[model samples]
Target: MTTIELDTTKLRADRLFQRKRLVGFAIPAVILAYLTYIFFAFDLPGLAGRANMDNAVTLVSDSWSHKVHVTRDNRSGEISYAVEGERKGRYPEGARPAWVTGDEVITIDLGGDHIVRYLPENRTEIEIPNFPLIEVRAEGRSLVTNLPDDLPGWISASNRRIGITTPEGRITLTGARTEVFNYFPGWELFWFTLDSPYHGQSLSKILFGERVDPARPNISGAMSDWWNNAMWRHKDVAWAIGETILMAFLGTMGAAIIALPLGFLAAKRFSPIMLLRAATRRLFDFVRGVDALIWTVVLARAFGPGPLTGALAILITDTGTFGKIFSEALENVDQKQIEGVSSTGAKPLQRYRFGVIPQLVPVLLAQILYFLESNTRSATIIGAITGGGIGLMLTQAIQTQKDWEEVAYYIVLIIAMVMFMDWLSGWLRGKLIGRKD
Candidate 1:
């Protein structure tokens, strides 16, 4: 080749290499610039400053522990002991906790060196190790305290109220009441309320020993009390769980049943008309693209909130997804089996049943079962919006901001439900379609 031609070829190769190198460096530089913008745009640097660690820490601690409230009414001079301050968990008449002592002046020992005494005439005494004795008096619409102006971080005081926090417990003095909350490690009164005769009985005593309640048999009474326990509401929770599962089942199955026929209409092989195929495909996109939660809100507004509303929302959203998937599967199906079925003089519906459907069963079952498990979790969130299932109970518990233990309980139940659904779906797949692994 000529020298001029050789020089031109070398120049072209060098320019091509430079262009490729520039493109590679430019792509990452663009990504880096975008991420840099996002970091400040999202205010990530100020996230820690915006967080309330005290409330977060308290919430985490409350989820695993229970507290008993020792409340004294300043107006009536009446003292009451209740678990988590719930009236249903209040101590019976003439009954009190072991930690409480004294007849007229009630003394509460909060396990460490923390002690609280409900003095006469709406006065309270608090003693903590390494600190001076703090006294407070709750009068009408105001508080009188020995707390200094230069107070510690653990103490919050105002003219009308005073709050003290220590490792052992928390104390609050107000114009209307004086309350001391002593925290314990486990959920109290979970099995039976204070009204139930089985509240203090041991497992062995209730099961094998004498009758705990004279009104009913030992086992039967114990079972009944636990089921109807006002604090836990086991029956209500069970029904909510059932409702969530029903929503998932009805929605998933309903979607699959409706999508199967619509799939045939969207497939190029089955649908000869371009307009019909395009319309069906667009319908699938329109429904699926809007999202399940959006559909949930719309349906809830129209139909009103219920389990059926949640189910219909799920059905509408999943039908679009299943239609798109089924249509694609239909388009890729083997035509030889269809031809053989036709040669046997099988009519359209019969050919579809024997030929098209048989080929699609494994795919159909696999997708259906997988979606059923996914929809189970989706139903939980949908139930929250529709006011129907365990999700509603969970939302209520979380909103209360005091019942973190119940929130924890509902969360654990939801995780367990999802795990069970996962196992059940896998088992069904194994039995009906044969497991791949």
Candidate 2:
């Protein structure tokens, strides 16, 4: 009875809640419809295939033991087998072996093909080639070269001759009428073809392709060695990185000197002259407005490319930034201290030197440390444009494409350098402005 009728307001609120629930239900349906449309709306096979191919390249399959099983549900008249190994494998069939067993390990002929219809179970297969044995004929010489030999060598006897060595391990050559050979090393084949007048590819252009002709010299080994060679091992890259750091350090120091006077001139309290303060502030703004990279391009063109150009650009950019920041710090200085110094009949310069400078020291030092860290990155960027730093080598490595590992190496070096700079900045800040915690 005290409750009387249901409150109309409570009923209204319940209706709003129901409306919200209905709207929420529609959101999932809309999202589902959109996803369905996107999945079906375009040809995505190429994109999907590319992603899968990338996975395939980096994938490492579990090592398969040499023991392989070949069974005949019922032997008709023929048999076949495949030989797979560390470097290469092949399937030889039709011209079947007299017999086969799962426990046996053997080598097959390179590029030999045979058909297998020997099993009623519909098993069709052939023996793989001997591990790393490639049937190679160089010029007029016919030989089965052991891949792991210090230099490739052919079997003294028949193509079925036994024994081969490679970097991986030793393998016995097996197979009747099957020849084993390692063609000239891959790099030799490449250099051979390249040196040939008949070869159309230039050394630089071929480098771009990273293709080593099979007929050339030890191309693969040479390429592998080259890619793995450390660019930083060279004195030039070390010199470049050193110059970049020097540019940032000296540039920051020079800008600090330039900014101190300009900053005081820009501060109304410090200058006590409105016109001089306004003019200095406007000049600071004008300089800092342009990006550091733009400055690099201008100076590189104007002064020519070198470390000097890089340092100059940093100096110009930081001067403006430091000027503005220092001016603000000066404006925030406590007036009471200035008055206390003035009451002692100190001159204006003396008053500022004794009163305002002490408070401004921590803020200025903090800003300088931060700017130094920032300029380190800027120096690398400037080096890139001016063709003089580790960045130049990085760009070259990328352009060559075959030097991807070198690219990886340089990237790690740059990241390490940045981490070092960050540590230095933190230490300096703690020393100059005491740790907050």
Clashing residue pairs in candidate 1 are none
Error of 1 at 291 (Å): 2.5
lDDT value, candidate 2, whole model:
0.60
Give the poorly placed runs of model 2, Cα more than 4 Å off. 1-232
lDDT of 2 by residue, 202-231 (tens): 566555555454554434544443333232
Name the top lDDT candidate: 1
Error of 1 at 329 (Å): 0.8
For model 1, the stretches where C-alpha displacement exceeds 4 angstroms are 1-30
lDDT of model 2, residue 244: 77
lDDT of 1 by residue, 152-250 (tens): 999999999888888889999899999999999987888999999999889999999998788799999999889999998999998999889889999
Please list the C-alpha lDDT of all candidates, in the order they appear: 0.92, 0.60
